[model samples]
Target: MNTDSTRRWLALGALAVAMLTIGLDMTVLTVALPTLAVDLNANNGALQWFSTSYTLALAAVMLPAGALGDRYGRKKILLAALVLFGVASLACAFAATAGQLIAARVVLGVAAAAMMPLSLAVLPVLFASPVERARATNIWITSTALGLPLGPILGGWLIDNFWWGSVFLINVPMVVLGAVAVAGLVPESRNPDLRPLDLPGTVLSVVGMLGVTYGFIRLGDEGWGNGLGWGALIAGAIVLMLFLGWQRRTAFPLIDLGLFASRGFRWGAVFAVLITFGLFGLFFTVPQYYQAVLGTDALGSGLRLLPMIGGLLVGSRLGDRLLPKLGARLMVAAGLVALALGLGLGALTSIGTEYWFTAVWIGLVGAGMGLGLPVSMAVAMDDLEVARAGMGSALLQALRQAAGTIAVALLGTVLATVYRSELGDLNVDPINDSVNSGVAVAKSTGEAGMLEHVQSAFVSGMGAMLWVCAAISAVAVALALWVLPRRSAAVGADEAVPAVFADVDAPESTHVG
Candidate 1:
């Protein structure tokens, strides 16, 4: 309530805005896809690439980015990354072709790889106590969560009222002012004993991540039969194996694999992965079912998700308060149960199913994720040395994001497969030709009945993915219960905000004491 407190909250607010930009980019781009395809004369594969490329690049560099931030400084890297992100956004606004947009977005993703987690890692240090750190994290999670769903509403408004470029242009002022606010208000911290960048480790990890992502995406298109998909995946695994080997031997590893030796840290990563799988996967699928099967417009489709959104807002707020009271075990377990129940319930939806029927189920899914995300994340870094927090959170976040993308690709592919199988006499070429135009062609070809079947397949695939999410959340819960010390022993571990990431991977650069 005093001036010092006011300044700290103001700093958190600025960081929240930074977090919002990252989530908004993900959702907003989806909303603008139709416009993008038409204006740029893009095909379905190209449109998919728009998102896929950014995701791929983001995942590939996350570990390295955090370390880079740490070795240099979280604040310096963060500000620099923000500047580049804004510039890239401006470029994306004027992107003349699909390739150009993809290029700039890839850059934006690189910047986001740095920005998103750093915001979380950085802001908590501003608050003095463990409770204050928890409260700050609660705010960060809520803002980031809201940004994803809010994107459609905001992007739709921009696209309808102005131009597609307006979406990217919106980031300009946020980035400019965000840089200024953070520089002035945020204290810089770094590992006092920072090491030089681990060049070989960085190269290996990036290649491995890029390969894995490309393989999954290619498989979505060409099936596992495609040699490229299988080859990239195999080679990617090998590269990643090599990267892990390097991590173990190197004096300065990109990620300290040793950290996972703690049961709590390992499970925390699992919890992160599970939440993204269920949350973003459902977020990706439901809107299509709404528009394609139920006949809602884009705006209506976006709005239909409000129940889940409402639940997210409510549950994230409540989860923060409950973590201290319940400890990690009960909270994460309960959240997983809610998530599985919601997804399993959603699997029952069929051709032309009622919205409200699924609404309750979807609401459960959102609420459950809200519970898992914050605590699981906080738990991972709870007991870590301050120097290691950046790498830990970045590692956790990258894994979570990868899980979401894989679910999207896997579920999307599964739906595509099932739709095709049940597609008896539908125009396969049209659907395969372009994601954006497929529905129009399907309608014209007397395949309207098939729409429901495809929708059902997608919902079914989502349920399957949810089962995977449940398993992972359970793993995370186990880690939290076992790895973290007993609740009565010490809660200070929970209170210590992960500055390694803020300070993004490598800790001292961004945070200062």
Candidate 2:
């Protein structure tokens, strides 16, 4: 209705575009992995690095990125990040070897680390009204959700028609447009009372996260008995314990440990992490099932996942309305119930099951994620002072990423271990490598039995993995019910917005320095 209102919504669009790039990057590379393996002459190890490098780099810098935005300016950092992301995307597109691509991905991850938190951090400053913030957040969630399915569909089409590099190159025009829009629309905001950077705390947090993340990743790659993996896990756990202790003692800590005192922040964070744990784990397994067992091409598989995106949009809309009425507790609890039911259905899927059965479960899980994730995320941010918005958002996202990484690692290990054990004494070297490798081998040798065996083994592993996901969702439901706050308490913690034309006012700039 008003000019200022229009600008803020437009600003949110720019932020959403930036967020969309990050989400697209997450899944876009996945479909190209096989192409990369051949074109780059990559071994299994190097192939894993292409993905892991990005994730590790992103995790390592998140804590610091948030502080940097708070100390300087959120908009300034976001603009710079957009430029860096575009440059990194170009590098990724032109990479000639696995090593070069991995290096490029690391840069892309660091740029994304800065954008992700600051994008959400600006929300508190943008839409001050609680009702408006909820609706804005739903749109923000949808933009990110839209990118997930787009990656597979778009990446599949690019890989099918063009080269593998085109997937990364496509990000260039979008990022450039996003940077221009953000520069013109988004306001500069930072914490005037923010303290100097805590150098020691920063180092500790980085070390702790990197060590833990690497250990889990190694566990997936090399298995449980690897000495290096065990050593990394032990060392990471010890370092993280020390980091927690330091956080408690530090004068100007990297993150305020006191924020955990609020039940809303604490449990909301846990539920958020659980949501990613299931979602990423499912994504990790389901695509391969489509390609390997169902004998579908990349494009077909990507198109098949469209139903989940539809469910996510519908669920997000429901969350925006239900969160205000049901409170965080009941709404998230219901979502987790839906998630568990969906996972349970997925666990029952066999090798020859129809696509519609899978779609029903996938849609349910997506809907659950749509409902649960935003409510929990908003609850985590609701009580945060505007000054700590960056750090709070960073902490929430960092934790979720960590959870997703661990979920993928653990669930992948489960699938691999069960598949291998079930296909014991196969004596088929190619078959033991992976489902894709086994299928290729089977077709080359013209052995129908081999394909059947591989399919059966993989289905067993998938079923077991989905059951584990269902169990986790069940636990999340109980935690949501037990720990989430009532409507009155959650509303009491909701931050208030000053008038639209207050002293700190404008269409272009809103918050004070």
Candidate 3:
């Protein structure tokens, strides 16, 4: 291969590694959640935190880290992130207690914060033309999306046959190979005019995010009736106000507050958050319905989700095709409507429902996600000047993860509440006793009524959670319409463009601090 061809191909491969790591980390731990809860002797709420901790930390750090990449070097940040991620994965694999595992997940999230946005932004830097850039981005999105949903399938198989830690252990070789490729092939680059880190804005953003996320998680366990839960939700909103004010005052903001002025960026962020809320939240519940109710194993549950994954691919391809034609506005709105319809149908699903039938509905959800995610992301970044691409990508990534965290936690609480209410009020004593002592004895011994009641309660509660997802998705349609208009960047490229992300049509230029 010629020098240019060699560099581009190598960079793509390195980026592939980053995408794989990120996609895998998201769903793999989810499959293992039940196992961790049982083995660590932790409660459902604690299990919820295991997921929340990682997402919260990841969301909190993403913007700050993205700025760091622009200020320092992406290659440097990417490589360091891989190393930390690998080590954290190993630590999680060996963790003997829930606390240890949650701590490890937190570390993993911090490391992963760089891998997502940096990888996305790096693609434009690698390819030289709009056509080439578009193609490269397509491949990146396809591979990453494929990897993300497959994490459950992969984890299911590993956990069903091997061990919970195996899910995490899988990252080891990928990281090793990825790190080597990135070190050797990815050249160092940065925006020379990167402003100082937006510390106040970062703090406020983190706090706001954590508040809302924690509140949702609490709902999973405590329900909205809990004062602490409502307080947290309200606090998150208040902190968000502070964060916005800080952004306005900062000379060099963590996020270019100006990017939101772009119709594409604003709508894209809205769609990104909504998409995660629908898909990730849906993914969390399906496995339980499969294994807990349908009596399928981990592998079977994930394999059953194959239709949704397929839908995602179709939707993604379709969205890509429609993007340049429709621009972002109509495409995202259509995608949101599709997602809402799918989730609305999915909520009606119940135990003993035909497996094949469920697949079709799942496909609808998947297709909606497929169309919404990449379409919005492409739109958000479409107007980005060369210099601000990294920051733009980071903000988008943080928004996506934040949305995912909120979805899982809030949905979790909703599910818990519905289940309990369905049971006519459940107590832990009966559940623990029956499941632990033996079903037959509990039935013969008088626990049958309570046991059946709780199980029914769980089913009902799960149904309620699904409805909430549907409503949120429906609301997203309005959000998309309002936030994502058809317009160019509110601030033109002149002031925002940093030296590094020069247009492909321009002479090839590299920047150094």
Candidate 4:
């Protein structure tokens, strides 16, 4: 291989390592939340804020960060964001109060927002060949994805042996390594045209996302009847509509709406969002089932998730092999079918259901995610021009992030509402609040039948939520078959270009730092 070819692969390795940290951050906190509540003397409200703050900041800053990377330099912005992410991790580690931790989490979110898009933006700059790009994209995606299951396992072990701060502190070394590697390996790249920032559009987008994200979070916590949640949801929708209108009129828009004109980009993005909805729903429900119902500690709960990871690895390998022959439409449809079948089986879970049964179904769900997610992402990205890579990727990430937040909220509501209804007029307000609270109350009071009631109620609720997820996956399968293109644009383009010089200079090139 040529020297330039080696350099591009090495650069992808650095970016993948950096992306691992962002993925770790996404789910690591889940295992740490119960511990944080005890250590920080936090209430349920504060516990929710810890996560909500991060989601809000991440959703708000992503679009603007993408525009900045396109206007300035992607590599420079990525490096800066990495440094800030490390700093925020340190701050979160030593935070003295709930409010301080929440504040630190918001800063972490902003840094992550910048990192996610710019890392993806560099892929087209490094590899021009469709085959090489697909391979690179898979590696990039797997690095980010592996961290999701790893988060619970790693966080659980750290919390068991070390203090809660270790979870946050763990990010420091990874961040430093990723930053150094990125600086040495990745070339600087940005749009040569240097479009002006859309300040009005930026404000509207941020406000709209904040409102909509926070609204769902509040509704999930307080129930669907919450007045504040309804108000925020309505207001955010109106603001987002205005933002869309502004984008149509603005000379230099934050996102290029024209990109969605490509059927590949539009359907790929839609399928990706649908998959995220189911994926996050699994993450949301399963950990609690492990901890509360199965009577396991955090470490045990995390260890139990290994089957899903195993399934994911198998699925990804199959997707990489099959995508070329079967094409995106068929491969993605097969993936969604696997996903739905797994969720459908998971809906059969009961209080007495065996661990092996749970493992089989969750593994299938993971496999489905592995197969569908990368192909969908690759299809969407295949349509982007090199100049718009940063903004376009940002738009896709923003939508996926929004979908994840909604999944957690909507699924949580389904679980909570069903759980409460099953318990029926329990005089204990704490028992009515959640299964965790009910479990705590039953144990403290040594109330007969209360523990049984809570466990059964929770399992029933979980089954209902899984059913909902299965239905959604079924819908995605239909859409994939109906809407997705028969083949990727990359495969078609690859027919004309030789593989060896795919990374060589094209008409457009990124300015090397």
> CA shift at 27, candidate 3, in angstroms?
1.6
lDDT score, residue 437, model 1? 51
| Candidate 1 off by > 4 Å | 1-15, 33-48, 117-146, 180-191, 317-327, 383-387, 433-436, 444-513
Ranking by lDDT: 4, 2, 3, 1
Question: What global local distance difference test value does model 4 have?
Answer: 0.77
Question: lDDT score, residue 429, model 2?
Answer: 63
Per-model TM-score versus the true fold: 0.82, 0.85, 0.84, 0.85
Off by over 4 Å in 4: 1-16, 37-52, 96-99, 119-142, 180-190, 383-390, 489-513
Using lDDT as the measure, the top candidate is 4
For candidate 1, lDDT tens digit of each residue in 275-387? 67776657655766666567665567667777887766566666666767887667676677777777777766776578898789889887887666656666676657776
Which portions of model 2 miss their true places by more than 4 Å? 1-16, 34-52, 73-76, 96-99, 119-142, 180-190, 320-326, 383-390, 427-430, 486-513
The Cα error of candidate 1 at residue 116, in Å, is 3.2
Error of 1 at 304 (Å): 1.8
Worst 10 residues of 1 by lDDT: 499-508
| Global lDDT scores for all candidate models | 0.67, 0.74, 0.69, 0.77
Task: Give each model's clash number.
Answer: 19, 0, 7, 0
Q: Write the per-residue lDDT of candidate 4 for residues 1-513, one digit (tens) a residue.
A: 223988889889988888888778877877776667567866444555676677667766777776688788998998999999999999999999988998999999899888877787788778878789878866776687667778889988998899989999989999898899889888888877677889999899888876776677667657789999889988988999999999999998877789898777888788888887777778767877887788877788788888887887788777777778888898789889999999999999987899999999999998887778767876777777776554555677677776776676667777877887788766357676566777777888898588888888988989999999999999889889998888774743222121111110111122211
- lDDT winner between candidates 2 and 4: 4
